[model samples]
Target: MNRRETRDAVVHFGPDADWVREAAAESSAVAAADGVASYDEPEADAGAADAAGARLAVCELSPDAGVEALAAVRDALPTVPVLAVVADADAVDDALAAGAADVLVRRDGVDDTALLARRMEGVAATPAESRLGAESTAQLLDAIDDSFYALDADGAIRRWNDSFSRLTGYEDEELAGMDALELFAGADRERIAGAIETVVETGSATAKAELVARDGETTPVEFTGALVTDADGSPSGIVGIGRSLTERREREARLARLRQAVETIVDRAPLTLFEVEADGTVSTVRGETLPERLGRRVSEGDAAEGVFADQPEMRRHVAAALDGEPAHGLVEVGDSTLEAWLQPALDETGRVTRAVGLALDVTEREERAVMLDQIQASAGEVIWISTPGKESMDFVSDAYEDVWGRAPETLRSDPMSFVEAIHPDDRERVEAALTEQREDPDAYEETYRVVRPDGEVRWVHDQSSGVYEDGELTRIVGIATDITVRRRRERELRLKNRAVETAPVGVAIHETAESAGPITYVNEAFASVTGYDGDAVAGEGLSALAGDDTDSDRLHAVASAVKTGDRGSATLVLYRADGTPFWGRVDVAPVVDGDGEATHAVSFVQDVTESKEHEQEIERHLTEFGEVLAEDLGVPLREARDRLDAATDDDPDADLRRAEESVERAVSLVEDLATVHSFSVEPRRLSESMRGSSPAPAGRDE
Candidate 1:
């Protein structure tokens, strides 16, 4: 090419004057050899670069001036291809962010001017349509949601999107062509530069950085950058997409705060907190000096060597938690004690990532429980706690051993063992009562029988209450009192009552009232007399069976005498079941209590109806016989007597004596019959011995 056809480029010196001079001299020599002219000074107004028709701006930027100064120079000449040169790798980021066309680090055997001139020749040879196509591509990227930017080989921001403006609080007019390093906070500039070199060499980079916004606010962001490549797989530039993580960061901060609050609370409690990783490394997060005992990581060797020497159960709990189930309650830890609550930690996908735990110091509570156990063991009742699902006994007072004739340890190991000890007939009732109580807490007080270890059966009275938490029944606490003696006594009393009710007598023991007269104490004979069962007239007083013709005055007189500590008797016509009248002689006497006071009246009532009838028949016969005898003896009494006396004297007086005896017997029989009728109509002698004991059985004959 001739001098007029040679391509031209511009070389500008920045803060590094020495590097700029050396580069300018070399570029001048190379341009001369290629028949092209290069300048270290600013291009002349309009006519200077028409020979080449295009310009390559090579600027030496000072480390101190950074990408900002380079950006200003690029803005001053908008159509030029700028190539930035740095003496150190630390300046590569600013150079690229400032929109350098290419970057050359200070090194031996590198031809700076020849390199720039040759690169300018290539740009100059490109068609205007290709450059327009590149600009159009950049504009399309500016419409994306994420802040997208392109870095030149010199590590400057060659292109940026409108989203960048929104993220950094900067307008396109203010920051469209700014340097990438200017967007980073002051402290992050060097780190950003290092990352840029890494991306250029490695073809990709990812990091979290704090960037300075237009408003001077520093916001956290995640930056992902990849090396833009040419057709030959050589690095042409870098394209980065930045995601503002302020919201995510804030959420993480809040979560951290919550965790801290939980740790504070848990640490202050009488509990221990732990976190177990998926690999079975347990870390104690809180409680006592656990942080000292259990370091940050629990090694496999340590675990195998019994590293948790003081708490072997912790390993089991961790294993359980890792399996996605919680392990809780008191566990032995060395010589101390712990009440642990364990749960699994989940990742974003809801898969178990680790296990966490909280443990409470239950030493004192255990001691108190032991003391309670001793007291309950000595007590006469059984106390126990049943967990949900009725699977096992959560706790059992020591009285279980004494009451059930089994060891409390055995019962605690298996609550169903105790349930199995219950009598088969009582098992259903006991289970029903428990179910009812669980459903309705107010249902309690169940009675059942349990067979002891010695095979002796005893009745137990159980009262239980359900323990509810979070609207679910968690456990049940119950007290059982033995009622064997009371049950036995009740059985015996029932048998005695049956015997008394079935007695074969109309015997009644009447209670005396001050105002009421003596009550009936009818025996079997009275029931037979009235043709009424004793139960039918048990509560009726003596007057209940009396006939209408009976005298009230006489009955009251007899009752008054009996009430005054004197025995009395009366004969009254008693009504039968068929309403027939019958004569009954009632003897009434006072029955006294231990205090020598009259408690009741005892009356012995006999059915004299047949006896009275027999006597009437006798009297009739006697009257008739006596009248006949009178007629037969119609002769004069003296003559009959003399005749009888002469006949008796002559006949050895035997016949006369026998005749007189016969007459005397006939008169006596008439008199006795009259006396019997009189006695039936009047009161008779009463005696205490004649009192009846109680009521008689049904249908007894008198």
Candidate 2:
């Protein structure tokens, strides 16, 4: 080849003057030594290479030269091949990514001068395509949604489609001087450069990289690139396609979140998720269950056999689910019961792949339901609940039939029927109490009579309390107890009280005590006889009618009888309500309780004032008569008897005379007694001296 024909023209864009000079000198020395030509165009304009008829473009990219300057040279001559020289070996990937046909990293005193000359010779010998062919290819690249770009040997952006501009939100003018490495976030630029380097070395490469958007937001992009070669089979640049993965990544993240949520629910819930194969074999199980790990088929497990024994229907349901039908049923194993639901799992072809099942334990709930049934059947009291203010009862126990003479179902259907059973006399009062309880949501209690269909009247004590929710009455729950026997005994007690109040003799009852034994009851006769009203003396001591002059011994005797639960009587001097004294014959008896202790005392009192006065008068008369006999009649008789005794001893005739005189004296004594009798019979008619004085001789003191 001729020297001019073998020599190739080169354009360099490095702003580092010293590096440019050195690179050019090295490249020229190698070209001359290798029998290739070199024409270095340092600090060249965009069109300098076309005017100089350059064979290859050489961009010397110093650390400061960056991607933009080199890209400007490459864009100026799209048909020519370009080579890049860089100072740092680490910048090789960036140089290759920017569309470098070949890169040289300058090491101190270590030159790849011969390699550079050969690469330039190969690029210069390659034929360039016509402008029309280039224009048509550019039009096709710009029409795609993905970003397409061409990078030079210097790793400078040479050409890019409109999609590239749209993806980064940059116009052609703004992108003209922009470095390709500046398109990514600071941290991702190296990674992107590495991926681009792989594409240049591997002929074709695919990787993920981060691209910075116009607003400074970074997006993930999938890059596919292939090296573009010159006619002589020398790498010239790279043609790349970048598809933004923003939407696809977002979809994947959402799927991950949804999967996490479902797993959380499965872990926390009481449900068990199971999978059964199409052949009716258990494949997997999750959540709370009989085992932590299971590998055998459902038929191989002992639990499955136990379930089949108690719930034959479960197998059928599971089978149906495996056949692409949804099914559910209950299965009991030992003491536990499970509610199992199953649905078919499908494949992409809509065929049944397996059955997915969920199981929940319902043992406690079923047992509680049975317990409630037992209580409702056996309870004696009528247990019930109802909606607040509603006429119909929500639930009622079977005891309603025995107590209210109506079925529980009847009351539940028409609660008014229970109210209608209330005795007519107490109906209004019972209803009023219920209304008040509803208004206040307090406890309800009412005792009223209920008239049965058989005309039997029975008393019932109904009690209820409101169930409140958010300060409002929601329901009423209560019990109604039969109290007929109790009410009947109360009625009898009232009749007995009426009889005691009207009793004839003075009757008083007092609590048993040593002192201040307060009177609790006083009959009408007691009030009249003691001259103290029953109301006035009730709570007063039993000795209220007994004055201070009353005998202490008699009072103690009555108190002792009451304290010891004994019976005793005393004729005591008692004062009336008017302060006048009277003799009373009182009989005291203790009222002992069931415990055999005297709790109270009852007394029967009678007035004996008139009879005692008459008896006293008779005793006074006897005493006066005795004095008359001794002093007046007895003295004369004694003198006569002495005379008679002397006569009898001296002469028989004289003894007879004495006896006659004694007889006469005895007759005189009789006469005196008669006079006393007359005074007793007519005391008021006698003089004041004769009334108190004995009827004796005048000289004698009576």
What is the Cα-based TM-score of model 2?
0.46
lDDT of each: 0.63, 0.69
Tens-digit per-residue lDDT, 52-113, candidate 2 = 45556667765644444455555666665677777876555445544566677767786565
- Cα displacement (Å) at residue 320, model 2: 9.3
User: In candidate 1, residue 371 scores what lDDT?
Assistant: 86
Model 1 alpha-carbon miss at residue 528, Å: 9.4
> Where does candidate 2 have its weakest 10-residue lDDT segment?
685-694
Clashes of 1: 22
What is the model-wide C-alpha lDDT for candidate 1? Answer: 0.63
For candidate 1, the per-residue lDDT at 372 reads 87
Alpha-carbon error at 660 in model 2, in Å? 11
